[model samples]
Target: MSLFLGLDIGTSAVKAIIIDAEDREQASAVAPLSIDHPHPLWSEQHPDAWWAASAAVLDRLAADHPKLMSGVAALGLSGQMLGVALIDAAGRPIRPAPLWNDSRAGAECAELDVKVADFAGIAGARPMPGFSAPKILWLSRHEPEALKRTRCILLTKDYVRLCLTGEAISDRADSSATLLMDTQAGTWSPQLAEACGISTGLLPELVESGEVGGTLRPELARRFGLRSNLPIAGGAGDNMAGAIGAGVVRTGDAYISLGTSGVYFVANDRFVPARGQGMHTHRHAVPGLFGQHGCVLSAASALNWVAGILGVVSIERFLAEIEAADLPPADIPVFSPYLGGERTPHDDPLATATLSNLRGAAGPLHIGRGVIEGVAFAIADCHDALIAAGASIGTIALVGGGARSRFWGQLIATVIDRPLLLPPLALLGPALGAARLARQASGGGLSHEGDRHGMTMLEPRAGWRPGLEERRAIYRQHYAKLPV
Candidate 1:
């Protein structure tokens, strides 16, 4: 049986998997990685580090499952998006990549918003500092030497693709996040590229998410003890790949991801710009499709923060305490959840997380439950906006680190007032999505059509609905009283 490789280049780590053409996992490996934050608003990782991690992961997989190596037929890659990985003429990294989480280009973003009024019309979304165009401008102005020496600009996955295939290429789904592509047309935007003072000559040729770019290079193949003929398929941004992995491929299909940050994504068949300024509309991995996603600065990260503050308690113990706590006080509390400001509803870094209506009786359990409920409510706000804008969201699929907790999933379902579908596999996340892409590229594999084999449904508890409603009402009353 032929096998496929799925490599996910994530912010914190790199995970690689070997799955048969049937989508059955044969071997898996993960390598721990870290990023460098040289400044308050900067996040970067050495481009070489990704290559190192990929090599480590592939070597370990081959070592663990020797039988699967020879059968590997194709490789697909998925990665954290919107990175600015500039490279020299020789294809060497010029500097550490500015990651998606780095927001230092805020001023540059404001400038683009002013200079490019048709930005939303062409791209389906507004430009943010977390995107690449602004980062490119930042490099040109702040690091002129590096910019002058640069001959290629790549995203996280694109860099990996280059190392494997010796070809610098990017997919539309990944390019869209860089704020440099014409999302509706699925092409590079000369207008935006010109405004950013970037030379289009250095950008990689764009392709679709599943298109074969090139065969793996000989040296890379030998290092991993694999064949150089294995096809390398175009991979997408982590969120798009995660969406595919979570089975949110159909129109109106939804999923809420809570990792370091949060995203609520709804797939749409046609490109549609959201009316609200808060939500982002971007192209989907499947060509000619788009999605409107809302961003929440903190999701499980806030919970993690609370846990650490209260002394590193296990998630099980935390939830048990929440379950034992007297039903959340009947009174509503307003929670901003802006431990680091917000992204969707309000794009303000100065916005602080404020929980109003907390009395002396409120303890850590109430706080924990409130934080989880607050995140769900925030997602609901996004869904409501999407619905108002004519996007139908029938149900939400939960995928991310946060979805692993049944208690949290239940709370989200109750608060959001929708059934939550959880894919059976969690470790697979984007890597599984990459495998699905790999299989699709190979002509035939397990289909993503079935409802039973890959999903677990979480419905709002019959008894919990009333309490959720009451809590929502209380939250609204308090939230309304706050200054806009």
Candidate 2:
């Protein structure tokens, strides 16, 4: 009678859920999180806000389902990777955490490229402005006072873990993306930390994803109506944990996540840094496994932005109307999906999204279609980048809020020129993946393996290829000329 609770501290929100031993979800809750963009290329959030949201969500879960909450044998966490939360000696955040998509560290990234030898091969990524290490350097130069008080630097989910357990720790899966880890060794790199103007002492202790990080504190347990001293499993980064939720455990397994941020993830049995290809090489929650992924800063966020502009209340409804109208693809303008800059294939934080080739004949529907097409094309760029970096691809499972729209999923499939699989209950991916880690921590078998059911296979529709190829060419040309 084991129950596992998993929580994801995402950029947009915190999603928490509880699952029984049989892997069926018993209860779930979501609490929205807002990001502050005080300046261009800046994304920050207070660490206390994250804990407040998770605490409220968990307390609600306990209030609603006391039985399920009591049965929880262990808990797990998953979250956005590459975010840096600096905690003082009193376990208080010294300042707002810099988010993964924050690009203020571009100059710092350049300095690292010149500082670290074989930078890409060593870091398992190019010195991108969005990674945690560069951001720490940015803080060192821009906000030295905060760094002086910092006792530990934690990734997003690890920040939550510190709150729940009163321990400073992180797992390989999340820490690997911090650019302070030697990806192959699966350990923190003092050299990298020194380069970032920090010491390894500031990092959370590294653990395997399924390993027990710390027990739940008594006060938290009483508030959440769970057993005191319940072990907390070390959870992976959202994308890596999400790969688990999507059943992408084995080598060559792949999936696409279209959330606030879009991710193209592929599993590998061992570390294979696809450096300079704009992909992240990260540890999988599964032991001895690794994942390579590319990210687009905007995906459903881009779609939702257009929907808001068009005054559409329901996304599914709007997409339905677009599909019903059968809008001619060529009539749509080309859109660049870089609303918050880009990572995969571009790695350019200064890049801006664009909508070009607009004509008076183009209506809202046309603009909507173009936005959708542009996102799909950008994801395809992620796919192409990975392939050129020497990773193989096949059918990909779609995982995220976007999976609900067949219109969006099918369009992405057509753009990638590969079949896509949409798993049932796709939106629960990262949190569910965290729950799966909890299950593992509780001594259960790897239950997520090979249990594919109720998944829809999407194929590339024939009619879209030719017109999209021409459109994609224009989109690429637009990118070639874009920086503003």
Candidate 3:
């Protein structure tokens, strides 16, 4: 049986999985990663750390599934999008990469809008601090020497691909989030590059998500105990890969992801950006398709925070306690899930998380329920924005770590007032999507019917409608009063 490997370079970890042609997972491994926050609102990681994590995971996979590793035909990579990985001419990182959650480029965002004419029209999104272009601009102003020495600027996963194949390339799905791509044209925008005081030559070459980026280098292959000629598929950003993994390829297919961040992602057959409203538009991993998403900086992370605050040893335990308490929805306090700032509908990086109207009687259970409700409301905010932008969201596939919670899934459905479809193994969506891309890059045809196996559905409870609506209104009131 032919096998494909998928590597995900995520914000907090690196995960790899091996899957056979029939999409059966043979083996998988993950390595934890750390982010450096040297300053407020700054998230950075060394590119070499990503390489180390990738190597460690690959080593584990090779050890556990030697047969699968040996027969692996192609590999695909996915990662957090909008990060800036600056590499010098010799393919070495000049500095730690500014990650997607980094918000140190506020001034540069204003400058970019001024320097680049019609920036929104070209980039298909507002200039935000989390994007690659603003980080590049920040470097140009503060770290001019490093910017000058920069020979290539690649996204997170592309840098990993560089280490594996000795080539620098990126996919459209990742590049489109950079605020430097002419998203509609599927190319780098010279005007945006000039605004950042850089040249387009510094950007990696762009390709479709499933295209062959490069083959594994002989030396690197030997080090990892793999084939020398293994092809590396141009994988996608985490959102796009998650969509693919959920079988959301055609128009009107959408999903809500509740991971470190929360996202409302919808596939589009044509380019339609909601830049004015702070939503994101990027190319899909599948060719000739586009994706629009609204992102909230905190999702399940908020629940984890509540768990930690409650002194609970496990999130599952904390959630169970909250559910057992049977806290009424109307009594739940309001929480604004802006712990790491926010994206989508409000491009405010300085925004902080808020919990309001907590009664003296409220305790850990109340707070926990509020956190879940807050996250659901935040996602619903994005959903409303998407609908306003003319997205016809019918049924949403809920995917991510948070989807493991039946309580949270039901809450999201109630708050969003939409039917939620939970695919089997939803947490593995991004990895599975990467494997699918690898299969295509290795000359295999796409047939994701297997992806839909054992799907489950969650419909909104009509009885919960009024209470959720009241909670949403209160959230809106408190959100409006938040200090900008």
In candidate 2, position 405 carries an lDDT of: 84
For 1-484, candidate 3 gives per-residue lDDT tens digits of: 8889999998888989888887788889999999899999899999999999999999887777777788899999999888888899899999999999999999999988888777877887879879899999899999999988999999989999999999999999889889888999999998888888899999988878889998999987876778889999999999999898888888889999998899899998978866666687888888888898899889988888878877878888778788789877656898889898888778889878889878877888898888998899999989989989888775589998899887889889988878898988688868788888999999996546765567888888888778778877877886578775
| lDDT scores in order | 0.78, 0.87, 0.87
Q: What is the TM-score of candidate 3?
A: 0.97
TM-score of each: 0.92, 0.98, 0.97
Better of 1 and 3 by lDDT: 3
Ranking by TM-score: 2, 3, 1
- Per-residue lDDT value at 132 in model 3: 90
TM-score of 2: 0.98
Q: Per-residue lDDT of 1-484 in model 1, one digit per residue for the tens?
A: 8788889998878999887755668889999889788987787899999988988998897778766876788888999888889988888998899987677887887788888877878767777757788888888889989988988899998898888888889888878877788888888888888778886787899888888877888877777778768888887888888887877777888888877778888998978875354677788887767877888777887888778877855976787777776455554354657676566766554456767667666677777777777777777766676667677786678888888787778877876778888877654778878877777777754236542366788887767777766666665554445466
